[model samples]
Target: MNIPSDLKYTKSHEWIRVEGNVGTAGITDFAQQELGDIVFVEAPAQGSAVAAGAPMGSVESVKAVSEINAPASGTVSAVNADLTDHPELLNADPYGKGWILKITFANTGELSGLMDAAAYAAYVAESAH
Candidate 1:
């Protein structure tokens, strides 16, 4: 429900904060709440190519395991290693420390396909009904 205004969102509930040509991405607050308590996470290796809308990682929760899709095409520049030890961080701070990947863009234009905060909030609202 906490959709930050500055970041772009995916229909699948992922969020990306763009800084220059790099983007830091993670599941949205709405996603973590829906997934329940996160128990484990897996991210793409550094330097790996991630195509937009493809699986870039996964999150395991008490309820189920969910594949995390990429919001844009890029090469993964960094992956959060801390997730191996403390997956609960995804539940605790999904937008901050819980970020999964830092990717250097393959095409920044793909960002135009993503939703803004207001649209995502509205999408979540409509999906609930």
Candidate 2:
């Protein structure tokens, strides 16, 4: 579980990297490993509103289809179109080329409630037990 110190995490497995007023969102490494061999991804259209904890997109793997929820609220600014054609990138690089969406946050203050690397690592560990 590689949780970067710079990002905040959601209990649902989404990670948010806030840069200025924009945020890059993706599934955590633990999430990708669990999903297994991602085959497809469905992302929200640009400029669409996304509410915190709500479904932002979906990821389909050999095991099952899982919804990728919003880690925070915002208007979706961009989606990684590469995933539509090469979904395996998610399994190969869950934190990099696999990033799902970029959003312009509705309220930066809401970031205070998100988990840090330590907390998210603990959450992952506890869930495994």
Q: Against the true structure, whose TM-score is highest?
A: 1
Residues 7-81 of candidate 1: C-alpha lDDT, one tens digit per residue: 999999999999989999999999999999999999999999999999988999988999999999999999999
User: Candidate 2 clash total?
Assistant: 0
Off by over 4 Å in 2: none
What are the Cα lDDT values of the candidates? 0.94, 0.92
Poorly placed runs, candidate 1 (over 4 Å): none
Q: How large is the C-alpha RMSD of every model relative to the true structure?
A: 0.6, 0.8
Question: How do the predictions measure up, each by TM-score?
Answer: 0.98, 0.97
| Superposition TM-score, candidate 2 onto the true structure | 0.97
